[model samples]
Target: MAIAASTSSPVRMKRRSSAHYRLRRRVRKGALGVLILLVLAYTLFPYYWAIVSSTKQGAELYTTAFLPALNFSYYRQLFDNPVFMGSLLNSVFVATGTTVVSLALGIVSAYALGRLDFPQKRVVLMAILMISIFPQVAVLSGMFELINALGLYNRPSALIVTYLLSTVPFTTWILTTFIREFPRELEEAALIDGCSHFRILTRILLPLMGPSLASTGILAFILAWNEFLFALTFMLTDENKTVPVAIGLIGGTTRYEYPFGQIMAASVTVTLPLIIVVLIFQRRIVAGLTAGAVKG
Candidate 1:
């Protein structure tokens, strides 16, 4: 009887212990929820402020509350500015050119590194990775001289080529990692079907890597779009100035006289496209990151 009673006591104690553990887990979960909410609010506050300022007229912007006013005259005025349109177009051209060139080079280089066994492959990959870590300012003078030698200064091509220094290594590394994960049997089967290497890459591997490519391409585009130093140095004409340079030039009066409202409006406009891109490929970006981490 005592042995049976001791066994029942242990069972009862285990049940109570489990219930207490569940209660503690629920409390921790609730606390974690509150912490996440606070983090999200903190992260989003700057964007919220920018949106509020964009909706206000210039006069109301300085005088108004943190919340947005019902007026949107500043947004209208910002669009009316000629520089805005010109800068927007320049940004588009530069971003598109950079994306195309960077992706083309990255695809070729990544394929070579990931698939082909070569002497000094590790050395070449290490060199690319190290080059990517070098500061842009450190290479600016060399880039400028190179651009001048090629007579490409003040052209969109100059910006595109310069951006490759930043975009190419990361893109190649990411895509190569993704490419390596593809089953070797698939490529072998393609070869058995009399598909050439180029045909297999173009028709099979490239199609499968669309998501990884898009994620890297969009990232390159955004980097090129937001680039300021090279854009300022390479592009001299007002018409060639990308949005970052344009925005910088817009606010150089006295601090008191800065066009905060218009700046905010332009900020919102510039950020809108990036926000859309991120939203569109958010899943792909997540997948690409995961794949790179696992495969690389």
Candidate 2:
């Protein structure tokens, strides 16, 4: 009887210990979730404030606390502004052109680097990396001169070409990493089936790389859309200005007594497209980023 009691006592203690561990774990997990929520809120609060402020009227905007108050006048006024539409169109054109050009070149260069081995391959790649790492400010003077020589200053083409310099190298690096992960066996089998290199790449590899391409394209689009410096420098004319430059114009122009509402409205408008893009490509971006992190 004594032996049985001792054994049962140990079992009860073990059960209590397990319960305590589970409770602690649950508490820790709840705390972690709260921390994440706080971090997300902290990061997103500024954009949220912008959206709210944009919706308020000029009078209400200045008077109210940094919270949203629903008003339609601000939205209507923003559209009624002549330069708003033009700036939006310019942004669309530059972002689209930059994405298309960068993706086309990035895909070809990535494929070459991934599949073909040759002398000076490493050297060429190193050059690309070095150029990519160079600050945009460092090359601004040369780019400005080249744009002037080509008679593209203050033109959409100037912005397009300049944005390529920012997008291409990073796109190439990302796509090359993605391409290297493709199964060599598939390419070999395609060759065995008498498929040409172009056919294999176009028909087989490209389709498989859709996610990576989407992720890179989305990033390039965002960069081009949000770009301010080149747009400001090259597009001195209001007619050719992109959204960022347009926003700057609104902020600087003192024709209006108060411009905060208009500026905030423009900020909201410009940010909407980027938010939409992220929503569309969020999954692909996550997958592309995480694919190389873990070993199969």
Candidate 3:
């Protein structure tokens, strides 16, 4: 009886430990899931509220709720305004142009910086980082001067040019980090096979950098899309205004009237493209950011 009791005591201890470990794991997982739910709710709640508010009319705007009564009057007002439609178009054009130009310049700059050893490389990189941190307001006067000198005021080109200040630096930094981690042996092999630099860039490195490209491009697009200071400063005429400026302008003739309905409607409308882009390329963004961070 004593021998049997000793064996069972150890067995009971093992069972208790196993159950304790499983319980701890469940607690941890439950905590993590709850944390994720909270973060998601915080991030998405504003978008949800905007969508709900867009469905409300003048009277309904006063009634705050998660779900609102459906009405298209605000949308109708937004669509009926020629200025609003033109601003949307302008935003798209400027954002797309900025993405293309920045990405193109960024890839070339990144390749040069990442793959080459040159004098003043660190200085150049530090300069870019410095420029990025400079307050937009500080550079506003200089940029306006440059823009006017270049005959680009009130033009989409002005916004595109100003946007490079934001996009190019970001794209270049990310691409440089990512490109630095690519296998140099492959480039050497391509060179041994008589591949020119441009051909190697186009054929070899680019396809491999797809995820990084998507990540940087989408970020640049979002920045340019949502930028207000440069857009408002450069594009003065109502016809040339971008979505942010136009949304700010969506009010009644007098201070007494608050056009919350139309403002919500325009906000919802302006946010759709950004949401779609994020949803489509979220994996790419995560992969690129993680890979760059981990490998470097």
* Candidate number of the best lDDT: 3
lDDT of 3 by residue, 1-296 (tens): 99999999999999999999999999999999999999999999988888888898766777767786788788888898999999999999999999999999999999988988999899999998998999999999999999999999999989999989978989999999998898999899999999988888899999999899988999999999999999889988999999999999777868899887788899999998799989989999988766668753
Better of 1 and 3 by lDDT: 3
Compare candidates 1 and 2 on TM-score and give the better one: 2
lDDT of 1 by residue, 1-296 (tens): 99999999989999999999999999999999999999999988889899998787656777748878867887787679887788899899989998998888999898888888989999999999999999999999999999999999888788988999999998998988888888889889999999988888899999988789888988989999999999999998987888999888886357768787778888889999999989989998888767757543
Q: Name the candidate, 2 or 3, with the larger lDDT value.
A: 3
| Per-prediction TM-score to the true structure, in the order listed | 0.92, 0.93, 0.96
**Clash pairs detected, candidate 2:** none
Pairs in clash, predicted candidate 1: none
How many residue-pair clashes does candidate 3 contain?
A: 0
lDDT of 3 at 79: 90
Q: Which ten residues in a row have the lowest lDDT in candidate 1?
A: 287-296
Best by TM-score: 3
Residue 129, candidate 3: alpha-carbon lDDT: 91
The 10 consecutive residues of candidate 2 with the worst lDDT sum are 249-258
Q: Which pairs of residues clash in candidate 3, taking residues 3 or more apart in a chain or in different chains?
A: none
